[model samples]
Target chain A: MNLAKTALITLCLMGTTGLVHATDPNLARNLAATCANCHGTNGKSLGGIESLAGEPKQKLLQKLADYRSGEKPASVMHQIARGYTDEQLDLITTYFAAQK
Target chain B: MQNRRDFLKTAGIAAAGSSVFGIAGCAGMGKGSGGHVVVVGGGYGGATVAKYLRMWSEGQIRVTLIERNTAFVSCPVSNLVIGGLKTMADITMSYDNLKSRWGVTVITDEVRALDTAKRTLTTTNNGTITYDHVVLSPGIDFMTDSVGGLSGNEALVPHAWKAGPQTVILRTQLESMKDGGIFAIHIPKAPYRCPPGPYERACLVANYLRQAKPKSKVLVLDANGEIQSKKALFTKAFESYKGLIEYRPNNELRSVDAKTRTAELDFDKVKADVLNVIPPMRAGDIAARSGLPLINDRWVDVDWITYEAKGVPGVHVIGDALFPAPTMPKSGHMANQQGKVVAAAIINLLAGEAPNASPVVMNTCYSFVDGKNAMHVASVHQYDAIKKQPMPVAAAGGVSPAANEIEGKFAHAWAQNIWADMLA
Candidate 1:
């Protein structure tokens, strides 16, 4: 009868049917795995490359936005940042930020 | 670090209002969804998949990797070895880490046959092994017959494409050549392994000859009309070699005289002291023999979302073996990315969950034009729901402004990190 109850019912139906609601829970984790090849597994880089794990999510997102906007001067990240949607970038940065 | 318990708790909370709405736990949830996966050819793709399967599965999924070579030698930087900048040891890595650290069963054996119906594979020495899912990452096998007299005479004219003995042999051939002698390299057509490899080999070889044998000349005989990758940068790099390096386009190899080290082209006969002929390539031998559907009778066609060979259940193929979506170069970086995708996909499938619908894979390929300077070409590909394949993002990735020392350092760091990413 109420909006909160209706929303809860919709979420319950989606979860029970194995449909993703809002976002796939594993999407952020999977997206962040892509950066592991260069930045290190879980973003803890080994060599000269910057480590992304545990960095503030907003900081990471801002840097990525700068790279996408051509405001940040990078050898490779500038070109790489333009590939993902804003939402995907948000999820990836959140996932990496959560990594300790 | 969201574990299965956390995921379930969130699901439970969402379903609390109704007893009728019950959440079914994924069998693949938590550690050890418990399936045996046998991966063939432990190169970039196979090794990464094998390691990631065991890792992401928390040692629950059994992973057995069968590779022909005992050690892992990277083809990415093998050009430097041919150019005499780096040695064979510098590019070679061991598979011990994959076995000891990751609990992977690493076998140095060649895969002979794939019994898709039974979900088993027969190896050269390891015998037949059954798997819930089988991953084939057998990299490109050269079409040696494409070049005349190139099949058995590899000792005379080494392709050095696979980055092992042939690499050393090619380097040795260059070392053996006298001053003012010609060292000719023949590149096969595009869509071969490592698009920028041939040009990098040319630059490195020229770099070697410039200092070691200044009088000697380097000749590149290419099948394609233009440079395959990093054209402008490679073109400019070639200019640095000026009279030392000569690049001929559209000159496909008709044949070769192995005895005299002479190349018989359509228009010209090139005589060289050392002839390094890189033949056109196809998916490895086992892949071709496995009866999977192939594109152009060369690359396997697979569903990009699952990396599963079309119509072939329980069998997945990745790396250069798959028919690339538009503009997807078959490089190690792309292969590693594909490995992770398949790993996550298999994990989800084993757990009865859906694969990631919005999968993304990107590539960063760096080529050394000289000993200390390199340039890179990068692109990112996201799954297109309409096309049902990963398409490159427009206005996203591009080549370097110019080759520089900083990029060269990054290239080295890329190698170190990527090697560790796959093996360590």
Candidate 2:
């Protein structure tokens, strides 16, 4: 990555971490809730879609990372994964991982 | 300890100021106490916000959803019903789950007036309701007056946009059309509800006609220059129907003859056996009458992060009602995402806490090109702190390579999942 692009990503990571701890405690849960429309409530999908509930945090993070990197092609997830910062993705996966 | 009076006082003071983005102090309720929230119009946006508020608050916040319709009728899969592939039951769902399971108080009444300063809403049937915050998600309403001779003739040329009785009416009209008859559907200008919806309807209708009435032709009289969404895919889908589908660009509906079933454009006038005109639209009537600031005198102007109306304090508007950000389509998926953002904001604001600094929302819309084949357009938008709006992520989000049956199944699954996400 170029220096500017790398610097931008680093700044985003620092900003995300700072905001999550300083502002809303429910930030992770709120971010995860945005996925409920297609994925189901708390990531326990109803049917026809993969459920994210109870998945290991590392596994979920790896899947999201792959999607962001375009390594694991998806119909929608690839696009969605690129929308979040790395810290935001970590929080979302952690939230879903805790869900039963 | 703050009481209900103190809470109202703080809200009123905050609302009266130049900015009402943040209200001060928690309304000091005891250990198990929370405030009440009133949601207007139990559609995709309204229902999702109501359920999320109740769930996140853990029953501390009381939620009352006031909607005119008794049950939830979805617009996503309603096109399949128009094409005769699905029934109304398939697109219809009950709001009982929101009541019984999510603990939302569903009131089947229309909101007549809103007092932003008093933080109260008056319904047509029920008495006035006071709330700590109010959310309006009334969707879009047609500007029938814009099209001459079309104001009171909706029964003759049904829009079927809201997906209830009008859907059934249009379906019945299609069913009664002769084998060789021409069914014409009109498309309004850009920035209408569901960017790809009109084209999908044309495809489904043509799909039905190709099988049942081979001699019949489908005319798509579009006001815009080209297809608004998934252009290449829809263009390819239209080619599959061959001579059965005719697409006309910039042929806006200036007027209509309801009696003769004729559409009057600037250059030509065409008559059809079944005339379907999707008229120009604005924010729902309730949003217009609530004294909220509107953009282009149509859509409500709202803050991207909180979905809060620009000038109205403690009143957030979502769904098709709000003037969308750059490249944001007025879609149910986006509305539900906005609903979640607003839900989270309201919860924090009610507790005298700051709302989340960075929020994310995305859209995934699947449109069926035929009975068993579908295509999709997906986009992801993140809150841009510099622009103060959600901008589309570069090098991300795109349309499907081609129409396929895999996405067809995913389309049906999308409808079922989204309906449950809002109501259930």
Candidate 3:
């Protein structure tokens, strides 16, 4: 990878305060609803796709980071992981993590 | 197949605190709480907004959804129904969950008119409903005038675009067609509901005819210059379904003769045993009727942040009625996303907080090429403050590398999951 790309990835890995923070609950819902297509609605999965409700923030963040990087292999997740900035991903992770 | 051993390890949703995005926090709050929001239509976008508003507000805001039909027949997987892979009952959903689970007052009635200024609406069966805010998710209406001479052809040519009886009409026509007959589908230009849908319909029908009646063929009359969405994947399907699917782009329809089962293209005339034409579409008729500030007298113009109609306070338009943001296709997935955004905005507004300026939106639309094979197109659009549009983030999302049976399974999973989200 180029120096800039490496630096950017490094910044994400280091967990710099979310590149962009979403405070509004609606923002959280809008982002969270997309995952329901595969994960089950409201983060509760009966089977097939994994349920994302009530996950720990750090664990969810790492999984998302893994998907963003090559460590985690997924067709849709990898592409989805790259869509948001470090901050947006962090917000989404935190949102799901807080669900119970 | 992206299989996993752990379900809990993978995913779920968090409902917590500490605002992250800069546009968080409730300001000017306490105005909308205890207020009523009347949402019209109960499709993906409408149903979601009604459900989310109640969820986020925690019973602080009262939501009433008014839809003409008691049950929602999804258009997303309706093609599968026509192809015989699925049935109408499988795709149909009722508002029972919305009423019981979310406490939303689901009213079954057609809206007669909307007085946006007064925040009131009249329904066919039900009496007038006054609200503090109104959300219009009227969905799509065909530009019938776009194709002339289709009046008498109504019974002969079926669009089958909207899910319900028309779907059965087209399916019956296909099933009854002679062994060597031709099935033709006319695709309207872009900005129509579901960009890749027509192409997907062609793929499913072609696959069905391939097995059901090998001697049969599918003819496509597309108005656009080329395949609009998932170009590579659909192009591949077209090649694979060879001898079954024949595509002719730039075949804009000048007129159609249902009795003769023929359409006059720009230059040549084409005929089919059974014809299904998807008419060009615009915002639902109510949007235009209420004078909700349309861009070209068709689509409703709104602030993407809040989904509020321009120049019309307390009115919001979501779903296929709103003009799409840059590169945003009018798919159910996107409509579902928009519903939440608008619901959140309404909730925040009632709380007296400014709506979030920067919001990220995403879409994942799965198109089944056949009963077993499916393809997908995903897009992630971030709110661009300068351009004031939702622009697709580069390299974040894209089409599946190719069509596969695995995604096909996931497509079914997606349909079930989304249905559960909206209805259950």
The candidate maximizing TM-score is 1
Clashes per model (N, Cα, C within 3 A): 2, 0, 23
- The ten-residue window of minimal lDDT in model 1 chain A covers A13-22
Q: Model 2, stretches more than 4 Å misplaced?
A: A1-23, B1-33
Q: Under CAPRI classification, how is model 1 graded?
A: acceptable
Better of 2 and 3 by DockQ: 2
TM-score of chain A of each: 0.79, 0.76, 0.71
**How do the residues A11-97 of candidate 2 rate in per-residue lDDT, one tens digit apiece?**
333333335342334677888987888888889787998889999999999998898888997777887788777877888998999
1 or 3: which has the higher lDDT? 1
Pick the DockQ winner.
1
Error of 3 at B393 (Å): 0.5
Recovered fraction of real interface contacts per model:
0.53, 0.40, 0.39
Ranking of models by TM-score = 1, 2, 3
Q: On residues A1-100, what C-alpha lDDT tens digit does candidate 3 reach at each position?
A: 3453344333322221223343333456567766776677779876656789999989988888898886997767788888888866676777788889
What are the Cα lDDT values of the candidates?
0.86, 0.85, 0.80
**Which is better, 2 or 3, measured by lDDT?**
2
Please name the candidate that would achieve the greatest lDDT relative to the true structure.
Answer: 1
Tens-place lDDT digits, model 3, residues B1-424: 1112121111111101314311211211212356789999999899988988887777778999999887999999999999999999988988998999999999888888889888889888898999888999999998877787786566689999888988999999999999999999999888889999999999999888988898999999999999999998999999999899999999999889888889888988988899998888899988898889998778999988888899898999998898888889898888888887788777656544456677677889999998888878888888898898789989888889889888888788888777777778
